[model samples]
Target: MAANSRFSIAVHVLTMLAKNCDGRVKSDFIAESVNTNPVVIRRLLCSLQEANLVVSQVGASGGTCLARQPKKITLSEIYNAVSHGEIFSPHPKTPNQDCPVGKNIEAILCRLQKEIDKTVEQKLAQYTLQNVIEMVEREKV
Candidate 1:
């Protein structure tokens, strides 16, 4: 199961905010760092806001800031924010239902997908943005 780039992008945004320590960081700066479009960043910001992972302020000095402390924000939390649908999307094409294996394949695949999602989320929950920052800082030469 492949996850979207939103997870990494969100981590980037949060880590940048953590370093700044200020109330907010503009989305454009974030977009530049992530090498993505400002419009994409804004859309992601909206989702993060809805998840309470981040908040937006309007006006000249307006931008986005973490809703909670970096140490408190888990990667899983970030994953949940921008992830809209299933973590593992099912096969788009329908399989033939005449065969026994074919009829039950979807059910078995779904069960496996759920298990994978749970395990992945559990692992992600162990790391917060603070941990990521520490790793990044340690890697600096």
Candidate 2:
């Protein structure tokens, strides 16, 4: 299955906004940077806006900007804003309760998935958008 890109895109959006030297950046510009459609960036922008991670403006000079400082925006907050559902999807149909392996598999995987999700959340909380920007600064040529 294709991995969901919402989280990564959300971070990219925020990072761009943090470095938004011009104050606000347009979706079209952000989309160009991400090499995806503007609508995709706009859609993700909605979620980030809802989470208060970013703000938008309208009209001739309209665009988007970060709602909080880079240091205050945690990766966990970004992940929570864009993420929905479990890390690992469950079976489409109910597992064969009649079969020993099928009966126990989904539940087993779900337990592990929860553990992983929690761990990921905790780790993400330890970092912030400022951390990403600093790394980017160091990597710049």
Candidate 3:
């Protein structure tokens, strides 16, 4: 399965906003940084807003900012906000079930995927938005 770009983009946008927390960060600016279209940024903002990760304001000097302190948010939170499907997905067009392995492989894959998801979630839970921001800062960006 293809990984969603939204998760990475959201993290980048949110990290930028956290670094420049004195004011709101414009979606346009975020789009520029991500090298994507502004519309993409807006769409992403909608999901982040829904997840309570960012708050948007409208006016001459309006933009977006993290809803809570950077330390309060988590990478998993951002991931969940934009990642609509499972971290991994089986083939939509089911594999042929004539063969024993083919029939049982789907079930085995499902179980293994669940285990992987749990491990990933546990690791993600340990890293907050602040941790990400700090890393960005340390990287001199």
Predictions: Cα RMSD each? 2.6, 2.2, 2.7
| Worst 10 contiguous positions by lDDT, candidate 3 | 82-91
Cα error of candidate 2 at position 82, Å: 1.9
Residues 39-69, candidate 2: write the lDDT tens digits. 9999999999999998899888899999888
TM-score for candidate 1: 0.88
- lDDT of every model, 2 decimals: 0.85, 0.91, 0.86
Q: How well is each residue in 32-116 modelled by candidate 1, as lDDT tens digits?
A: 9999898889888898899998889989999888888889999899888877436667779877799887788999889998888
Give the poorly placed runs of model 2, Cα more than 4 Å off: 99-104
What local lDDT does model 2 show for residue 14? 89
What is the TM-score of each predicted model, taking all chains together?
0.88, 0.86, 0.83
Candidate numbers sorted by lDDT from highest down: 2, 3, 1
Candidate 3 per-residue lDDT, tens place, 65-84, comes to: 88999999988788779874
By TM-score rank, best first, the candidates go: 1, 2, 3
